[model samples]
Target chain A: MKIFVCVKPVPDTAAKIKVGGGASIDPAGVKFVLGPYDSRAASKAIALRDAAGDGSEVVAVAAGNPNKGESEARKRIKDVLALGADRGILIPDESYENRDPLAVAKALAAAIKNEGEFDLVFTGRQAVDDQAFSVGPMLATLLGVPCVTDVVGLEVDGKTATVKRAAEGRVEVLSVNLPCVITAQRDLAEEQYPKLKEILKANKKKIDTFSFEWPAPAYRVTELSPPPEPAAGKIVGEGPDAVPELVRLLREEAKALSF
Target chain B: MSEFRGVDFFLLDELLTDEELAMREAVRTFVDREFIDNRAIEEHHRAGTFPRDLPQKLGELGVLGPTLPDEYGCLGASSVAYGLMMQELERGDSGLRSFASVQGSLCMYPIYTFGSEEQKRHYLPKMARGELVACFGLTEPDHGSDPGGMETKAVRDGDGWVLNGSKMWITNGGIADIAIVWAKTEEDIRGFIVPTDAPGFSAPSIEGKFSLRASVTSELILQDVRVGPEALLPHSGGLKSPLMCLTQARYGIVWGVIGSMMAVFDEALRYTGSRTQFDRPLSSFQLVQRKLVMMHSELTKAQLIALRLGRLKDEGKMKHYHVSFGKRNNCKAAREVAKLGRELLGANGVCDEYQVMRHLMNIESVYTYEGTNEIHTLALGAHLTGHAAFRG
Candidate 1:
């Protein structure tokens, strides 16, 4: 069985980012990173392949300049490839950087189509940027296969897959078909618990770069603006009075009365 | 010992984000294959030398000199990733790690930093590929802790330098193809990339070692060893050059000590849970619980210190004092944890098969080398108060 995971190189969430002079995300000082959730999804996919034995292969693909030197993004993708992905598919084009989900999804779908056959597709529930959580669904639609978004647990039997998604208050379980897309949620199995030996062997994992036709997409961002900064918070009252005051503010001022 | 302060990788954050999780997984995998099932470790300790081809295996895994700028055939990876790799390597044994430390920080770092253009072009690529074994010569027979007091001298020849000195307790010695020897010239201390094949230069393996037996220890003898001008590291000057190398090694140890301590603690924890004493699991005892709690708390806090320091290193604001603290604290804590682990195991812990005694013995050398616990404390004390405490 052939497994594929859609990984994206993003800004390390731990690193603080400052806006540069232009609309562009200033990568000059930014630390490049593999998306955390995508690592988890990829781990899950690799685990499945390993469980099935030597005939299985885990192919890792990314939606950025996947194998360019000096690009931290590409370096991260390579690191992931080393993590046990049998082969890597890096789409080499700066145009894909910060592109719309539809554009990135199209690039991935085309690669999947080119590969001809795959039993499973895995991806993070959402990329760090904007937290759109749209790529898995978009890719599934483009590939004309079933998709399980925000999946936290997965089980495959024959051509069917039982996926568990973390919902608002409860876990929503859904069964899908083989060759389906899964957006791994953060609540899912941990993405990084690298056993020592695996880290050393990840170097052998193959990473391949590709540049295929993506053509212009219908969707384009009119503007790139920062999300409004959250307003400052202040305590209304102290001690027991604060609780009652918080209730009053929730009921009257903010009108978010959970009680 | 205090909490670990860790390395100052003030520039690693941006570089590590994308591959942090992935690289971590990869390294963990490599460690599992190399260390866990390694048949050579116990034999290595008994034989007193690491496996000859182990370095090549690590190089193939992309771990030998990662984080080095790619020009030198390094991975040019995130500093945190490098630290993580070091930590995992050490979990197996300090002897194994000493090889990497010498290769990466002690040997490769100096060449990358101070070697002449010709030296860098000649030595670095092969070292990264593990085709060449490298050793750092700083500590002398009389100068293990006080490297500045080294009596090694390099006198100028017609177009070269002739070195006269003997370095002591050198790790990865004996078989190193090259050595980064720090010698005090007439005017200043300088680093030299001395080839092992150089006439008058010989490395005799140090015998009768109690700790780090799985690693090679050697005494480097340089009797008027003639070297070309290209051999002298042009950028290295004064006592600071070798001190900087120690800082890098110490920084790596801060994280690595935690890994070893965790392993000892984990083994002890597992053993206590299974061993029945006085009709109860050893873990049921209050004393055992306290030890476990201390080990856990120390491990967590040490981890945080190293992690925070690692962040600083990633950010490009890390300082030597911070690393000094981390080295001092983490090494001391590891020794304590290892001892506690041994105590928890009773007589069984002292045996090789148990592995606690190995760690316990290993931590002793770790404490003494790379700036001893006393040295670090005094350094920190001097930092806190503008005073130099060392006296003849």
Candidate 2:
């Protein structure tokens, strides 16, 4: 089995993100980490490969800008490899950053094609930085494979896969055939922290780099603004006399109560 | 986990190779997950218990003598990579680093360097995988700074040796399955690989240690312990052999203490900024700023010294005195930095919640062990002045 996981290097969630001019996020003082959801995806891919035992290959790939120094991005990809991926592929093109999710999907699809055939492809449900959640589905569509989104549980047997996902606050199960796409949710598997030997070997594994022609972004950002600040809470009158006022406020001013 | 405030004022990351950075990052991630959990560490400390099966976990990580060759199940990585691992481990806690340092520099190093080919094949791989735990027994109840005067002796028997002595202040002593016991013979001092399960060998855990609370320290006793000829470390001839092992451990200490310094420095930085005094952040005060600045400078200087020493060690040009200089200077600086960090935390400093107090106590042990500061200073003094100062 050839398992593929797509990883993204995003600003660490703890970093203080600043909106620069032209609505771009400031990179200064921001520590970059492998996307959290992507980590789960990578972990799942490695687990499945390990479960399959002999002749299983896990290839970790990332599509990102080359000019910003691909080492940081490459480090994120290496992180997955250190977790047990067999090889790595990096598609380094400047346009990949802040581009359309469709462009990223297409580029990732091309890179996957360039790496020969893979029986399965795994991606995060969404990158925490953008929450776009479009890349995996779009990539699956481009590759003409069956796609499953927000997969909370997955089991693969030979040519078929049984998956469970959350649907309308309920559990939903679906079975799909081989050569399919999976966007992993947190419940897929707990990410394994890479150990020292794997980390050392990850440095020795050569990451094959490639570039893809990016499509025009479907949309562009006009401006950026911080979210609206929350309003201060107002106290209704004082003691038992306040009950009627609170009820009136809830029923009239807030409209939280009908009676 | 909070983002670590890595004080790399010298742009040192640029000096490291891409692989070195990757290695450092991975170790940092592991440390953050495993040892840096203050709540768990404090719990273990309060109970005076080491995390069970820690050696196996560390073995899986390949942190045991990572600089050794790949054939032994080690990483075969550069010395700098090994130093970074030590740095990150000590940043989590000094006791944690000491556990690894003993396993690698003390136990495995001598075996790899002095044991026969058959012995190396038998022990190195298993030790690296942490399948077998071991401890080094060089310091004795009578001899610490001066191991030449050690009272332990191994007398020749029919085709083997009978050893009788006691070793104190041995890290990992209680739980170790194998002990590299250095004892005097009629010809010379030699290292013997004695199984802790041998008939007369006993290791008892030393209780009530205020320092290295997160780690295990023990006393090893040997009463007429007999061992076969194969038990001897072939290439080890005299006191110089064990001192070489100490050099390896001391080199690691130079790097390890810097990690403790970095951790406390980062804590102080965060605490001062967030803690308010007189309606203003404590960081706003000039005196607080002075202390922080002092710690920051000392930590920065120590990091440079350790990194340079690491590079030199990788290059095979590092001298014993070089290690002494680094170990002595960095340990002293780390002690001062931890103190400044504690003072900056004020009342909260002494509490386990802040954790600076733990590093403060641990650094005191680091200062005394692996050749005390005075011993190292005298070594440096002897090197500069062609006089043997100890003779007087």
Candidate 3:
């Protein structure tokens, strides 16, 4: 079995983000990491490939600008390779940050098609930075294959795959044939921390780079601003005598209570 | 603790190769996830227990004797890369770095440099994988800085040797599977690979340590312990062999203490920036600002020295005295940085909730071990003045 896992480089969740001039985030001082969901997707793909045994291969794919010194997308692809992916493919797009979910899907579909047939393609349910949750379905539609999003568990036997996903506090299991797209949820697999030997071997793995003619964005981010700071707590009074006043303030002035 | 952004005032990151940076980042991430974020360092320190599981994890990361040849299951990392690993490990705790130093430089290094090929084949891979833990036994109850005065003796028996002596202040001594012991023979001082389970060998843990509490320090007793002739490190001839191992460890200490400084400096910076006083953050005061500046300045200088020494070591240009200079200066600088950090944090600094006090206490052990600050100072003095002050 040959598998492909898609990944994205997003700002580390702990980074203090600042909006740059115009509608973009400042790239300066921000550390980029492999998106958490994408990491899970990569782990699942590697595990599947390992189970498949002889002649099985796992390829990691990503798309972003490469002109910038040490492209983050390329680094994220290398990270997956270190986690046991056989090889990698990077699609360079100078304006990737501005691309919508559909645009990214189109680029990934084109890259996959150009690489020939694959047994399966894995992706995160959504990119943490955008939270769009549309790219997997869009890519499957472009490839004309069935897709299952938010998959928490998976088992493959021969040409068929059984997928488990959570819905309304219940798990829904579905079966899909070969050549399908799977968007991984958090429970898809446990994260893998690559051992140093794997990390060193990854430096020798092949990562083919390509350029794509990106489609015009479907929409634009007009402006970006931080969420408003919460208001400070008000002290209406003190002790037991303040209880009636607090109730009155909540019910009348703040209009927070219906009673 | 928030993520460590690395304190590189000199843009040293630009000077490092991508591979070196990646190695450092891997260790940094491991330290954060395994030790810092989970509060394992603090918990283990308070409980006065070693994190026994750490060795396997660190070995998997390929940091154990990382600079050794890859043929022995090691990473064959550059000198600078190994230094970076030490720096990151010590950033978590001095005990952690000390564990690595003892396992790698003191034990595996001597084995690789002096042991027979069979010995390397038998021990290096298992040690690299952390399946076999090893300790160094050079410092004895009667001698530390003057290891030449060691009284441990090995007597030649028909096909083996009988050893009798006691070693003190041994890191990992209590739990080590094997010990690389330096002993005096009729001919000269030699290294013997002694199994800890030898009939008469005993390693008892020393209690009541106020510093490096997360680490284990023990006394090793070899009472007429007998070993086969094969156990001797064939190439080890005299005190110089053990001193060579000490050189390797001291080189790592030069880098390790810098990590302690980074931890404390970063903590102090974060604490003073947010701590409000007199209608403003404590960082606003000139006094506090000066303290921060001094810490940062000293930390940066120490970093430069470590990097230079690492490069020299890689280039085969480093001397034992060079390592002494680096070890002496960096350890003292780190101690001062930790002190300022504690002062900056005020009462909170004394609490384990803040890392400053922990680092402050750990630096004392770091300052004294692998040759104390005063010993190194004298070593450098002898190097500069062409006179040995080590003797009266």
Candidate 4:
């Protein structure tokens, strides 16, 4: 089986993100890591390939420019390969900062198609940076393949794939045939930390790069700002007296209960 | 912003290869997931029996003697990479690092360095895989700093040797599958690979330690323990042989102390920020700022020194005095940093929940072992003054 894992490298969530004067975030001095969900997606692809035994190949695809030294894009592709991916394919695009979500998806779709036909394609539910959550579904739509999002568990038997996804207070299971796209959630798989030997091997694995013209973007980013701090909660009364207020607040302010 | 856990003050990470950084990250992640939140580690430290499964887990990571050849199930990486692994392991706990150090630097190293090809083929692969845990027995009951005076003797038998003596403060002792036993022979000091199950070879666990409680420290008793001629390390000779092993372990300790210091300082930074004093964060206080500054400076300096030492070791230019300088300086700095960190947390610091107290206690052992600070000072003193201070 031929598998493809789409990965993204984002600024480490734990690092201090400095918003620039132009409303763009400073990339300098910021540590980059594989997007949390993307790591799960890559891990899932590697797991599937391993379970399928010999002759199976897992390829990692990402959008990046080779001209930009130490760019997040190239690193993301390498990161997936380090996690046991057999090959890495990078779509060389320099306008990553200005490209909208749809344009990014188009480039990724082109890269996947350039790799010939893959039995399965995996992507993260969403990149941690920007939280766009659009690329996976958009790519699936472009490829004309069945797409499943928020997949926490997956099982494959021959050409049939069964996926368990998280819903609002419930789990929904879906079964699809061959040539499907899976957008992995956080719990899809426990990402494997590659040892030294694997890392060195991955470093030596040459990443094949492809160039493609960017399609007109469907959307544009306006302004980015940090989320507002939550308001401090108020306490009223004590003991039994507080219970009535709590119930009233839940019903009135929170709109959490009725009648 | 969340407190940054990756504290690379001098961009020392830039000095590392991609493989080295990746290896460190793997160990760092494993440690954070397994030991950082583990209440049982503290419990075991209190109870005196460390978890037996930890070495197996480390073995699965192929961290045991990772700098050794990959043909023996090791990583076949550079010495700097091995030092980084030790640093991360010690960041979790000193005992864990000690366990790896003894197994890798002390036991596996001598076999690979001095053993016959058959012995290396027999022990290195299994020991590297953690299938067969081993300990080094050089420090006898009376000889620690002066191992040359060790009384453990190996008398020539008809076709084997009869070993009679004891080793004290042996790490991984009671549970070790084999021991790299160094004994005085008719010619000179030689090492023997003694199986723990051999007749009259008993390793009893030592109890009630104020420091390094999580380690399986033991007293090894070899009463007429006998082994075949093949058990002997063919190439090893004199006290310098075991001292070479100590130099290797010390190289690791120099890096390991940085991890311990980093853990302490990271916790101290978090504690000072969140903890309030006089209606303001304790970090706002001038006195607290001074303490944090001191710790930050010391930790950064130690990190740079260890980085240079690791580079020197990988280049094969590392000398005994170099290890001494790094080990003695970093261990002492760690002691001071842990104490400051403990005080910064106030009453909460003494508790295991904070881990400063644990680091504080662990640093005491690190300061004494791998050559005490005073001994290192004298060694350096002799190097400079051209006068041996041992007699004085």
Candidate 5:
């Protein structure tokens, strides 16, 4: 079994995000980490490969802007390798900062096809930064395979996989054939913290670099801005004596009281 | 709470290699998840029980005996890497760091350095895997600063040795599977690998006071505990062997205290910035600013010392007195930093919710362990002035 897991490097969720002059996030002083859900996908893919054990291999694939020799994408690939992936492939594009979900998916689909035959592809349901939720379905369409998104549970046997997802308060279980895509949710798999030995060994693993020419984005981000600061609270008074006035203010000035 | 970005005011991170940085980040993330976010330290501290589950988790992270060779299921990490791991663990709690230090430096290091090949093959892998917990028994009830006065005795009977002694202030003692017991023979002081399950071997947990509450401190009592000749560490002899083990642990302490300092300083800094006292945040006051400055300044210096000492150790140029210098300076600095952090927290300082108080209490134990602050000062004084102050 050959499994390919897609990963992306995003600004750390704890980073202090600021808007740059060009309507994009400021990169200065920000740390990048592997996308959280993508790590879940990598974990699941590795577990599947290990369970299938006869010459099975898990290859981590990542695509992003190398960002002036920082090579965050390559670093993320190394992280997945540390998580027990046998090898890695990095697709570096200087223009990736502006690429839409479709363009990114196209790059990944092309790279997966170029890497020879693969039995399964795993990706996060959505990257935390953009939350576009379109890449897994797009990649599957390009590869001509079925895809199950927001997957909370998965079991693979023989050439088929049973995927479980929640839909409208009910679990939707679907059986997908081999050579399909899996977009993992939070509960898809438990995160694996790599051992120090594996981390050291990951430094020695082979990560082949590849480049792809992405198609023109179908949409553009015209402007990006931080959310507006919240309004200050106005103390309406201290005791019950102020309640009638507060209620009047809520119904009139604040318009918070629909009753 | 936001992630800990680390306190690198002097840009000391630039000195670290990629692998070292990655190792630090890995341990830091683990500490956050297992120690801080889960409130394990607070719960265990309140319960007065060691976080017994942590050792296996840390073992899975390959932090136990991390500097040892990979053949024994260790990471064979660099000295700096190991120091960074200690720093991160101590940031979580001093007791947690103490556990790893005792295991790696005091226990595994002795076996790796002096034990016979059979002993190494028998114990190293299991110890590294955290399947076997071991404690070092060198500090006795009557002897601490002066270990030469230890009264533990090992006598030859048949083809084995009968050991009788009592060791005090032993970390991981109560839960340990084996003890690296140092007992005096007629020839010299020797080390023996005594299984805790052996007859007449009993480790009673000591009720701790206010310091290192999350760790177990025990009294190891051995009455005619017998072990085969194979239990002896082949190359260990004289008082110097145990002192050599202390050197390893003290080196880790030099890095570990810095983690406590960083924790308190970070907590205080965050607290002052948001805490209002006179229609302004406490950070706006000049006095509070001074305290914060001092904490940051001292923490930066401690970081530099730890990094330099780690580099020297890796280069094999580190002397025992060099480790003493680091232990003395960093421990004192950490203690003072914790004090100032506690002061800045004011009424809230005593609360466990703030964590400054926890670090403050934990640093007290770190200051006194391995080698007390006064002992290291005397060691350094003797090194510099060619005069021994320890006796007088």
Candidate 6:
């Protein structure tokens, strides 16, 4: 089966992203890691095929340049391979510096659809950096397939899939047919621990690449600004009296109080 | 960034390629789901039981002995990837990572690096699959700092050898299926792989340990334990052989220490913000801010050093002294950071429920084990002075 995993490389969500003096995302000191949600998607795809009893080749395809030190993308690729994915397709994008999210998603969709056929597609619900939450749905629209967002459970049987999604404090079940895309969230499945054996196998797996025409821009970023840092607030009173004072501040100052 | 210049940090872009990340991601997902959240870890830590099914869980994840080369069921990810895996595991629990380190770095490494091909074939794959738990023994009660004074001796007994020695502080010792023990012959130090079921072999649990209590540390006594010539590690000679394994394990420590420090640092940072003090959150104080920044900078420096060393290790340019420097320096820095982190937590810090004191206790063992900080300093001094300092 040809399984495709589409992932985006973003600066580690936990990193202190510095907006430069020019208000641009600073590339100098930032470290990139695989989008955590996308990693869950890739992990699930690999697990699904493996449970089908081996001999399945899982391909993780991502768009990124390996030279600019966003090294997170390649590292993510290595992570997938180390977890038992058969191969990785790294499509380098020279235009990623200022690429728009929707445009980037469109380019990935076109490139993947053009190169080969896929039985199913997997993606994270959202990339942590931009939190655009647009790519997976957009890609599914491009492919003319149904997508279930925030999938916590998935089981594929021939041409149909049974999926579970948690919403409003309840588990919602949905059934979709073959070739559907899944946008996985963090709570989906537990990530596997890498053993020494698989880590070694990842080094030997074949990584093949092909360059294709990157689709022209379908969206553009007009501006970027840092979110305002939360201001430090003072604590009033001490010990037991502090609780009532905190409640007073929450009610009167921050206005987040319930009663 | 300047702190790490000229040091090859694991440049994921040009180095790891795409395939490696896929593999590592799989492992990370499994750990996060199965082990990190496993309440059983705390249960076992409390009950003093070996993580009974941890080997199976590891086998399911396919990560035990992960970087040992692909033919042996290893992932063969670059040293950097392996280091990251250690970081992730240590974040869950230091004991869990210790399980893998003893099995991989201390046990499997000696066999792979120094054993005969037959020995590797006989043990590597099973060990990799987590079918067998292996332990390494080098430290003895009387001679941790000076392994040269080790009293354990192996004597030739016709077609086989009779070994007599006692090894202590051995990780996975009591339950290990196989043990890679370092002992001395009349001429030099050597390594041997002895099956735990071998006659005259006994591994007794070392109880009442204040550190690494979650992980099993055992005492191994060999009374006329016999092994065929093939059991001997053919490549081992002098003190460098066992020390080489220490070199590998300590590099893992450089990363593992950071994982612990991050936990404490992150916790302390979060606590101060929520904690109330004089007319403000404890974090509002200038002194607290200073403590936080100091902890953060120390952790960051240690992280960069570990990452850079990981790259050098991948490039095969890592020197013994450089590794020692990272281990000694990072371990010392982490110990200091743990102390400050606990102090910043005030009354809640020392309690295990809050966990900073646990880190502080663990750092003491990390500082002394693998080779004490003083030992590393002496090793570094030897390089600087163009002289060996073991005797001096």
Among all candidates shown, the one with the greatest TM-score = 4
Instruction: Quote each prediction's TM-score.
Output: 0.64, 0.93, 0.93, 0.95, 0.93, 0.77
Chain B of candidate 1 achieves a TM-score of 0.93
- Model 4 stretches astray by more than 4 angstroms: A234-259, B1-4, B38-40
Better of 1 and 5 by DockQ: 5
Predicted structure with the largest DockQ when compared to the true one: 2
Q: Model 6, range B85-171, lDDT digits (tens) per residue?
A: 666566556777788888888988999999988888889888877799999988898989998789899898887788998998888
In model 5, pairs of residues that clash are: none
Residue B260, candidate 2: Cα error in Å is: 1.1
Report the CA-based lDDT of candidate 2 relative to the real structure: 0.88
Task: Tell me how each candidate scores on DockQ against the true complex.
Answer: 0.09, 0.65, 0.48, 0.54, 0.61, 0.32
Alpha-carbon runs more than 4 Å astray in model 2? A222-259
Write down the lDDT that model 4 would get.
Answer: 0.87
How does residue A13 of candidate 6 score in lDDT? 56
**Which ranges in model 6 have alpha carbons more than 4 Å from their true place?**
A9-40, A51-109, A112-118, A123-157, A160-259, B1-44, B55-68, B75-88, B186-188, B300-324, B380-392
lDDT of 6: 0.77
Q: At residue A246, what lDDT does model 3 achieve? A: 94
Q: Once model 2 is optimally superposed onto the true structure by TM-score, how far is the C-alpha of residue B251 displaced, in angstroms?
A: 0.8
What's the CA error at residue A6 for candidate 4, in Å? 0.7
The digit string of per-residue lDDT tens for model 2 on B207-286 reads 98989988889999999999999999999999999999999999999989888999999999999999988999999999
Q: Model 2's DockQ?
A: 0.65
Q: Which residue pairs clash in candidate 3?
A: none
Indicate the docking level reached by candidate 3.
acceptable
lDDT of 5 by residue, B63-116 (tens): 899999988889889999999999999999999999999999999999999998
